[model samples]
Target: MEQSESIRELTQSIEKGTISLPEFQRDFVWDITKTYDLFDSIIRGIFIGAIIYGKPSFEIAVREVDDRPRKGQGKNRKLKIDKFTREEIANKVKVNNYRIVLDGQQRATSLFRAFKGIDEVWFIAKNESDYDYNEILDKNLSEQTLEEIIYEISGNEDKERISIKLSDVYDIMQQNWRESKIEKEIFKKQTYNGDDDEGYDYNLEKYLTICDKLQDIFKESKLLNYYLLDMDVDKFALFFERSNSKGVSLKFTDILAAKLYAGNFNLRDKVDEFKDNNTAFANNFNQEIIVRTLAYIIGDGREKIDKSYILKKLNHEHFTEYWDKICTWYKETLNFLFDNSYIVSQSWMPYENMIIPLIIFRWELGRDFSQMNEKHSEFIQYWYWSSIFSQRYTGSSNEMIIKDANYLRKVAKGERILEKAYFNRLARLQINTKDDFYDYNRKASALYKGILNLVNFQSKGLVSWENNNKLNFNDNRLEDHHIFPKNYIKKRFKDDLEAQDKMSSAINRTLIPKISNILISDKAPSKYLKEIELKNSSLRESLNKHLIPLEIMEMDELFFEILDERATKLFDIIQNILVDKQAYILQNHYKEREHQKGYIEIFATYQNQEIQAHLDLETEKVIYKNEHYSPSGAASKVKEEVSGKATSTSGWHFWKYKDEEDEVKLIKELKE
Candidate 1:
């Protein structure tokens, strides 16, 4: 095992095609930001982990490192040989002792590109100010701290900083880092004009010191550490799986790809082929979620749909048998979502993993959504809405998938699954108040996406802003544009972060045609509305379609009023869709228990004031200040009243009640 290999040696090896990736290794996917961080760590002499290399007992196919292609893009576009076959390798090249990268392919490829100046060149920017440079150096090199010392030049004029390409540094390091030579090379054709010779010399020395450090780090630092092993392809596959299980950043799909490759099935090529054939579906859903859905379908709710299960149970043969059927089911699932107006595209999906359960649910119900009965359809909608509003599939939702799949199967047979507290509890815990809508911004939030879906549904299908034609969900023409323009908000709010957040809320965004977005660029809502009204006679109707108040155009600078009106409207839409028989049953169930258990007194303290509230056992709500709120809601209400800002609170954790023994316990404790 070689524990010490200089950066120059390894990069040179990569340049000479002596060190290459094996055919089964995943392509490099690291972005420029990661490349910058890697070099930063190298310059700081930090241990950036070791790469593992294996010497095959026999000749193996290998490929040269190439620039990583974009998602769904063809790889090895520049290289002549995508993969040299074992026969071709034996015939073409006489080398058999080269090592294949088992781990750290991303890091190796990034280094190779930076040193060879392929695709994007790497540079280090340091402030020329002596005091600032000293301060930057003295501080501990955290990411934030490094931002002041190192940065990429963006072709902007900056008199206070000097930048040098990494390739140039590599050249200087190769010459054994002579100071006079490095200074002449780095600072050529530039002379100090300052009268202060001492200060100029100090800055010059500092710049020269940085150059020397770069050379020493790259030329002399033994950072390219690796473990050398001799193994066959089968043993290497096992090693890959074992290494990933012990916490490598390799994707499960990567491991699966390696295993499938052993069986003469190329998962990457197959996925790319699928994407090529189905462009629209591919655009909507990512490769990972699609593969995961296939895994879940293969598992069929009996096994966990994870990496281990997929690797062990889903071999190349199983995947081959089910490939066509799974692909068909996924296409059908997309159609179901579109037909139901749940989402027009994958962007509006609350969670990609949510699709896995839906796929299983629909497959179990006979793979045809049209044949689904009204009751079953209604239950599915209930489950869907509850999952979105409650943010059910946020993290580690494999268990939820199995549970939901089993429950949906029973629901298909007219079984009562909603009677269980688990089903109804989702509705109670999430989207309980209008505040939820008010707090939502246009981030990658499930609540935010759910709100947009609600708007689309209420609009009876949104139309293009340019032509009043109904939107076709099949393509990329539909865009979520801000009603209150982001440019207008920036100018209006300036540095007011709270105002910015309010202006950028999902309530301020709506689905519009791409052309309409360009037409309404940066204009105030009032200005655009008036312009739109002048051209279109059905302006009021259009506003109503988007759930926006007609009177909003008349109001001057009343952004808060617009937000409130739109939030209230969206909240009503949510309530109408999600409040069903199950919610009523839960309400009544609580009411039935209230008589037997009376009201539980709950209280808490905030800002030196004792807040008194009582739990309404019947409705499972907290009575505070003569109004009912969810436990968390009451806590937020009290904080808002005193602090003058909305806050998210875990109601169960906030309120406390005395048990029968008179010992005080949290509301969460009681529920548990």
Candidate 2:
């Protein structure tokens, strides 16, 4: 029962250092991203404080007991007990040790920030709550208040948040009462159930009081120097780990790397400076890989390394030698192939199309390549997402791609003949006309043919190609717009067999414009074709010219039919690109026993090293191209899919209606 006035008086003295915040108190308890957490507790009237002396330097906490006889009023910092139930206080009624909050880690940290200098400490109004999607999509949010947004989504709109006065927080903790105040015993809380060391589990209410006290001290005292000596490495690790509630946890290994060179010196900070680099942790590679590399680079066995290890390791002497190599690998190994588009947004590898495995090259092949090698950019991008083909790929197709990655690596390392084994079809390309897929694949028999074609074509450049006497697109920027919307198709159709069959077919999807996707305005092309033909004369005429096969103009079905023809032409354009892609990989076939895994098929080339040892290793990749038919014969379908979802009757099990004895009739009843 600390009185507001008494607590203010004591807090004023505490700010003067005449009194001190006790130790072993709980932390400020609130839920804000960070700054908001500090703000909300004060506004809602919760108690927060800090402690100095258990482990490390200190611990942030809410005070459980103090110097008071019964509990009428308190005098230290401003205090409030509106939410503290008798049960909660009773629980912490026993333990006693030193009793003064020395550091309000979270609060002090928060208030020192410019944003927290608020009307008092920060405080979100008690009215805030959940979000309603239906409301957000249709309602005018511009005119709504935070409370209103919450109300729209939350049935319990009237629920209030914790609140308290700023002055009373730090003030009420420093009182000189005649009798000792017994606080309820607080237990070590659990944040995550995975492991004891996993997450932060602290009381929120106690933290704000500490923030208030620290804020006052910062204002009253002109102490430019911060002495977080008690806030040593362990506490630093603990405090930082506990803080992140909404986002992801900062890996201990990363922290270990960070700790290697503690101080103002930044380890990961340099990553921010690079162009097109997402973070210090990843280049074109995703964040997880970078972290894994960091773990391995430190030689900390991957699992043992963390921020602490990093902090301990970083220094002027060793930081450069060890970290420089990683940075080099990051910029080169990672950058060479990380096509942002190919990276399917996964934790491992930038694009799970499998370019991530290339990092292993830095160790196996060494760093002879630079990120700026324009000649190799296409090679790298293809390799990064090469797995897209690999996952669905098999046979010579896969072997071809492996040879491709090997070829690139060898070529970079000054190896010749690496391109010889890479067979690419180049016969289709005519100096005067557009070459189709089969014509191109014909040139793909040898790596040299395709390489020559690629070198010739690329060296000619698009400007040169357009200038030549061949049909060319005037537009430099070609966008891959989906013909069938992935999201829209998913939403409108059930995941049943028919819907899935339609959705999965490549013929159903195609690319469109960045500004204007033709798929827009709802009613699909079939429904809207007639309107389009009447609206755009140029489109109608273009459709007539590129009729693909025979009677396109004859059908007169209109826009969709015309659009379908153009889309087929577009697919041809895409097919040509794939042909070049195939040639690129074909010419660069290094095909070491190591990359044999990528090849769907390989020859059994014996080891040149040992005669008795029949073979050095398996000289071929075990993969193959699998041909499949969609439910409707458009896309490939697995045997199971063809038999199960597509078949009219159960293909897996047969029913014998003509059993003379009906032998299984009794068994059927038992089975059921």
Candidate 3:
């Protein structure tokens, strides 16, 4: 059945406990800005879509609507949800016919909050002719014409802009306009002209017309319509799936949770238990990782673990069977990662999906951590670094996941090592240019996290200036302290977002103690570093531990200079990690001849056709036909060009470098 209610009636229903949300419904995620837009659209007579309400045959948990704004962003952010007690719904509240908001939860909640004047303060523009909502409504809320009035402006004395609070608009819409206090106020504000009441009366009429229109906008009950669904649990579930197929669809995990609940298994409870123990990891990688990894493990490392795989093939029974063992494997994997990769916290992980393979490696090796030998450790480290530098898991990684998982199982038995060709490709793709490090986004980029991991590994973890103690992830006090603070850079760059972004680059970031960060807050590095160094005796060691150059920090107001210097230094570190031995060996061979800047020329002969190539000593890439490639990649290309088909060839043995005395030697022989 279909039903219609005024915005006021819907809000009243919410208050009276006749309107509620299912326990499975996600909490209100609308920010204050969204609330502004919702009311703005309603005021303009725009259709904001209809709500979908359902009455289920079976009893289910229900909750009150979350009318609060979004608290934070990223890891620290959440919209709090509170479930209503059964007793309150059944007896005390007297809600025998309450309906669940199957759809439009955000809209319904936003309307309710706006009507009640909760948390956010909103205002309507008095001069409707000054700005057209129709024109700017299609754009972002920040770019809209009504941005000023829609914001919190309760104390604002801008008489030309805001006419009234939106809450007051709702009140006036429900009140008798002629007898309302607002109507009397409008009449009182009327001005006199030459002792004649004509001008005052004209002004009074204009103000009343505006108020009437605002009243009529909310007073119209047909504007807020809803579809009422009355069905059994099974039919209701089907309707829920179909109705939610588009437009902010439920997360696969949520759907899976619902399915498991019906089957007498609680996926969410198990996930909550796991997350309770591993807060850091769970904070970064949520329940999706848990479900996906379980599916992969259950399939013996062959499952795609995509939405289809999870919904159809993921057996809750298998999940329960392997849950405890998988948890143990994850812990062991973390232990190994901490020792080798220096990823002590979830923040440093290059990719969350990397956990799947690492766990699988540990699980496939043995039940005991003692069984992981030197070879296993070496292989795991190689795979870990190779995958990160190659950016293997950046995009669609299902195929790569299966491939790597199978290889890891074999590697566990010492069947083979990750090929040199693999590392060669990783070296080619590794962060090479100074711009690469500078462009690495703040905490969001995998390469940025990879660099952090590398720094942590090399420095054996950074020490804090506060007490010169190594900053630990377990402390919960480690902050992403900006070397050049955000406020300092914002003031320096002043409205240049690009310059601000560059200044706030990951190169300008390092982990420090919360106290140290607070003490150093917003002060220029030149000013703060001096004070910090004066207070700490091991300042040099602390700076070195964070890979911060002492001389660079001493330079006042050279943010870009610091950025460039740190970028070069970080690139050097990354290059060392992904250093191709053949490239380095050839460069070193050329260095011996004092040809530091010039390219290393190597030659190959195939069927009397001589091929010449130049190796860039810095980048370690071969230049043939003006295109750069890794030695092996170039070798394959050259062979394919001449022979019309190419197989993998050892570039070391194929190309020969000529000595100054006319002696030619294969690079492989030179290695000896």
Candidate 4:
């Protein structure tokens, strides 16, 4: 049956315990801005949307009060619904008679809260024509004030305030006009000029008249129109789905949540509690992920496990049974990821959905953590790296997940090894190169995370450089440090953006303690490396732990050659770890050359200190105090020393030396 009711009657029904919200409905999430817009639309004679109601079992017809107030109510205060108790309502109503709001919850709650003066709802004053609802202006009133004037105009008692009709805002406006007339009369007697005074009075009268008209427009009750569905629970679900399909306001998980709620199982709340309890891994955990995991465990296929099927198939008993097992396997899987895989937390995890299949595989292994052997560990590691390198889950189809899930199930049962085909699929994965490994957007990519995992595996765990103490996942002491300091690169490149970017890529980044990063502060790798070696006895071992090539410690300058060598070494290390290859020799990429070959020493005095540099006449390579530079680049360093700031200098004009004739001449003059 369908019927129409005024906003007043609807609010009254809510107060009298005839209407309520169901437990399955989402929480009141509307902000004050939306509330303001809702009332603004109503006041402008605009048609606000309709509400949908469902008749549920009387036992489960419990309603939660709409405690979310608009602005000007005390922070975190909810409007109390005093007249009805759940017990009283249950006793009074039968199963088919219980009405629960299926839609328009925000509207009904706003109306009920406004009418009862439980919260202040604001509106633009008619006197101000250009008011925007978003701005914080003075032209607003509390719903309580609006209600008081309405009652005074209608000559209603204080007890009538609770049940005051929405239509009464019109009568309240009429009373406001009557009060304005009395003020106009008093002002007319005090200053009476025929034209100016009467014109002023007329405009004042017009403004007051507009205020009344605005109130009249707001109180119109046709805005509360709705369709009443007197159907059973199953029929209501179908109707809800069909109505919401095009709007996308509700998701499949929401319908599943509703179904679980009807069965006295609050899935959403349980998931929330799970997240709260496991706060360490809760950053990326959400209801959709939980439902997706549930679907994998019991769903026939990805497509079938959608909204419609879940609404029909999911029940409290099945959900509870599977949820418990999933929870157990989920915790175990996270432990595997952290302890073995080096994924420290959810933030470092690239694809959260990847855990779903792992959970399924773990379940098939009899949920026994002790059964995991070296072969099994290798299989898991191989699968993890291969999936990451292959980008297996990025835009994966439902059928793909089904196939992978089946494959993993076989692997878990020792039926197969991760084959050559899987490895070949990732053979072209570009992670071996410096450019590929040193990504700027590494945090969001799986390869970056995989590299971190490999580093963690090599190091046993991350450690603080300051004290050589083991740092855990929860510690905030670690940060990404540029191996070749950014400032040094900037000095080296200056205006060359491409070079700066290359130097600052992910290959240069390593996790070091915050204290160590700060202490390193733009110092050259040559300086910091020696200091660390002096402080720590196990210098070579510690350097290797960070996946740093031992050659970097001895290098005079961090060149592209160093970065490329280290990146290739790290990639090989990851490859060996993934394939369980032992006794694989690491290839040395370092090349030997004659020291200071084909170069002549040039001396300069800057800031009263003698600086020496060597210039390679054949290659045009200038070495300033063992650091490589161009001739002009060497002059820039000298200029920095002289001015205590970076400035461009002409090396030809800056450098002078005694030529073959035993006369001092500038390099520029000699070249000319």
Candidate 5:
């Protein structure tokens, strides 16, 4: 290995296509902030990292050249002939060699782009007092020359200034040596008053000094450190994988994709094309999923989907032969999810990996959706719901997936049957209840998607309430709205994380027309319900169509009761869809309690002050002072009185009513 500490020379080599990235090298992943930071580090003479390059043999180097096209070429193909081939060995290019980047691709790309004056790289100026940093992308100076940029920055402009391209800065200093000498002579000859007359000379001297500094920075060849290794492809591959194992930036699939790239079959490009064709499936599709799908189709059922396994087993021929068939079945699987399960979008489908099994199943059935028997369909649906509710893929996923794939293969061969025993096991799996939906982690769970599909099903189709036009789920035309309004909840639980979490929960959320969300604003459900009801005559039908409980429309404020009732209704609908038989039921815990018709006084001492509230059992409303509220609202009021901020609290747990035994018992306890 040969070592060099020269950024300028390295960047030039990159520009001339002498130091190029190998197909296996990862793309530029650094963002604008990171790019700015890299320049800052370089300016400060910080040792960022070392770049490792693999020097291939003469023949291999020629093939690896970015400018040369593959053997079978077309007139329209974009190719660049190697500079070494054109210059060093002009007529006999066979003896020339090139180095491909094995590490530090991002850092090299960053430097190259900055020197080339690419507008994508931006600097961030940090403020001392304020923690926030201001992003400085000089749009006006992007296409300007170094002199123009310097003139603009020095002018009386309101905008922030930026550094000029390093190469251009170097050129300016190189050309201005005589000019700087003459300026110094003129400044020395001038007889200036000890006043503003000397300002011009001072400014000119400072400008020339700055130019010299920039030249030194750019002309310094040993600014960066790098290692050049002479090795073959197999040795380079082994070394690359071992070195990258310690870092998570590169994946096994990424390496495998690069290997396929050598054979003119770019897995990443194909995945991107697939995504472009099926936008709905794109977000959930990734290299790992594609590799796993390929493994299921081609590998022995026991093989693990990892770097060693992929390199040893998968090759260009396997990919080229199975690529089309895999894609066909994958698309069919997506359509199957939409047509049969009412999951129109990837967002509404929990467990994206679940699609892999379905793909395998459909492929086994020869990609014929019509041939999927009722029993097979039931089994697939059961597996999806069961896996989601059970969180089967949350841990030990790779191992479990292999096992499931093996089982599925057997089922496809008519050697197994999905029976009641499987359903019974699924029934024992903990279902994500209303509370679970409130957690952000559960947002993508199967139950969450199931609920979303249920709403879509009840709506007949997701149509825009404003124009009655059928909405496309793929296009982000709809947004989830809070039934109770976030502001109203916040007013009760101010700056409370738990309260904010609940506001984002599944039970509180409902899909509505994007425009309708704006119209609703932060108004309480009671207020918006009346306004929307007045505008649309079919408001009741619309509510029912959305699977919303009609009881909520009559309420003055949202409460746990409404949430519980709606959750029960939604869970029942999901149960009906998941299983043909009504064998599984979610147990309801809240029961009505016998109480007097009039308001019952409830009291609690908070922060040395007596807090009092009233509960009307008949109306199921709580009265705090002169205002009417639900239990949650009243409890929130008590919390506000104690903490001096609105926060969510359990009214049932906080407020207690006196019993006939002269003992204070929680309202929730009384009800139970």
Candidate 6:
């Protein structure tokens, strides 16, 4: 019913905010290859235009906001929305209450780079026209040569940054190309990758061509603002749905990034920080991966990955401003990578879902998690599962992770006061009296402290949770043999707590000569022990030194024994080091955190607080101000609690290999 928009017209409007980015739009993304091609095309005089070919299928959802309560936690926040689309299997069908993309999710993103613009501008050979360039020298710049002037300027954006206009680059190239064409090639060779490895190759000649063309297009093209599109925003949405006939894919986090960008924020910095700090988090993940991770934290519509609608709701300011908090949730949950609680369907958490609890508790508990704890890890997992079965997201199950972080706020009590971790840690104990507190605190307890005394044994070693901020899992390959092969542990013991205990428990595990552990294959522990003994005569003759004489050497079966023995020796060797952890863990050592206030210390916090909580899927009972209040939002919050009166959730179902009794009861027994 309408004509399509062109690149020049859209870029102009986007720049003026006349065709401002829709809150639901995805982040500014022009990947390395595509970014390369776009500039290359522009350099070659290619124009990118939207070609709307048919009567598009669209969904238009319009609900006036009236401050509805956010789902779950009842922390008093705005309601979150989910989008539903009726796609045609046989024929096209029109729907209502849907949102869609408008234009330049990628190209426009390049147009508005807040950082790369100011940060990397000096690299471009531009003068002061298209860009406002600061003469690097404060005085007498006219007397110095270009090389001298360039040397005087600082290239570091983190330090004092300098801004150079895009147009200036073209003008500089025009003058340079006109006089000394060979210099363009030389300058091009000096180029390095910009902020995005996923960006265009810096070629002075090619870049100059594109900018010139774009400049011309803006000056000559008749394409108007996004506002002047003639069609209602609703129709534009419909047009976007049908326009995606090429099966274009977009991630929800990308959409959130767009919203954040619209709000004048950039995620690249934090993402880069994660990359620079944690190799696994960076090298293993991409922009899309982060988007999916964000969606996972929030939601993408059950397990469907609801990219289309998730962005729509994010358009609202409430969700947009909280992007940093949402990302924090993902990094935190990722660290829970080793928690056994994550093995089950409901006991898990998506990246999006983790945000809810994290925000409710309202602590930057997840920042620079160069170090994190199993409790933080488990809570992240638990929160993820809660969001999934609870249907927290609007996109693919993987994308709904963003749901975890949306609507979380900090209370007056400060970040360290959050009681969840203490309670979660204490949950593993069989408590009886006040002294039971010691037994429950494995993280800071004497045994735990002693286990970490490896650093003292040698000049340096790992301090679990202390330096976990940075992932140095196998930092020392010199010793500390993984009693249970990591691969084997993940496979058979993924859901097994006792199995984890067997491996992590001191008796079954110990530090060995790294070389010996490497040579040991997947044979029984006895076989490996024999190999070790034969390799070193002194070690072979003495059981007291390394091997605690065991009747059964099935390392797999008696893994905990090994863990216990080593832990015993390790603790004994460093008994003097064990005392009040609060006194020594470096006030803000990254592990001991307090929750922000108003969040009922339901699951963790305040040793003095009494426990009167029932956390079934429905009716999340809260113990607040020494009293319990729940059975309020039960029917709506929990699917299990509402699966029918007979539907009961098993708290232990999520726990893996709890004990030997948990094994299936035997008949006369298959082997017996």
Best by TM-score, which number? 4
Cα lDDT, all candidates = 0.68, 0.33, 0.65, 0.59, 0.59, 0.36
Ranking by TM-score: 4, 1, 5, 3, 2, 6
How far is 481's C-alpha from truth in model 6 (Å)?
Answer: 10
How do all models score by TM-score? 0.57, 0.35, 0.52, 0.59, 0.56, 0.29
Off by over 4 Å in 1: 1-20, 24-51, 54-100, 103-225, 228-250, 474-477, 486-501, 515-522, 534-536, 556-558, 583-672
lDDT, candidate 2, residue 464?
A: 17
The digit string of per-residue lDDT tens for model 5 on 110-193 reads 776655544233322111222224423332322322222232221111122222335444335435547556455432333331
Each model's number of backbone clashes? 2, 112, 0, 3, 10, 111
CA-only RMSD, every prediction: 16.6, 21.8, 17.4, 24.5, 21.5, 22.2
Misplaced by over 4 Å in model 6 are 1-249, 259-263, 268-270, 277-310, 315-356, 364-517, 529-672
Give the alpha carbon lDDT tens digit for every residue of 1-672 in model 1. 667787888887776777777665655677777777787777555778898887654334466787544434664465423444345444434464467788888888888777665534444455444445346455533322333555553322234455555666677765665767766665553343122433656555655555555555676646668888777545655677677733555555665665566556677888888888887777655666666667777766666776556655666787777666777777787778877777756666777777767777777777487888877777777778778888888788887777777677766665554234465556753667776776777557888888888777777676655556666766576667787778888887778786687776788887776644336666777788777767666767767778887777886377777777888887787777777556653442222212335577899988888888999876789999889899989999999998899799899888887654344557775564
Q: For residues 1-672, what per-residue lDDT tens digits would candidate 6 score against the true structure?
A: 334454444444334433333444433434444544444344344555442222223222211111222234543553233222324210322232122235544554443331123222232333323233555434342443333322122232211212233434444433444424433443334334233322334333333443444455444443422222334324444555555544664343544453454344445455777678766556443454444334433432233334554455433244444545655554554444322222111111123233334433334443443354544443343333333323334344332232233212221122222223322332232222222222322322323222322322222322221111221433333234454565556565678875654553334433333453335545555666556555555543233433344533434566555555544554443333222222332232223323223332123111243223333222334433344434332222233333433333322221111112222211112111
Off by over 4 Å in 3: 1-23, 26-101, 104-250, 277-285, 368-371, 417-425, 475-477, 485-502, 515-524, 552-569, 581-672
User: What TM-score number comes out for model 5?
Assistant: 0.56
Of 2 and 6, which scores higher on lDDT? 6
- Which 10 residues in a row give candidate 1 its minimum summed lDDT? 587-596
The model with the greater TM-score, 1 or 4, is 4
TM-score of 6: 0.29
lDDT digits (tens) for residues 1-672 of candidate 3:
677888878887888878877667776777777776777776555788999887654434556776544444332344333333334434423446677788898889988887776645444343434545664545533333333324333422344443455566666666655534765654464232112333544444544554555556566779898998875554555566677644656565665665455444677788788878877556554566667678887776545777667666665577778777887787777766665535746656778788777777777787665677776655565567667866888888766676577667767766652234433444556565878766776677787787667677778776777668766655566656778777777777788776777765678777666653446556777787777777787887888877877775567566677667767877776566445433542232122223356587888887689999987766767788999887788889998999899879887778787644344556554333
lDDT of 2 at 504: 28
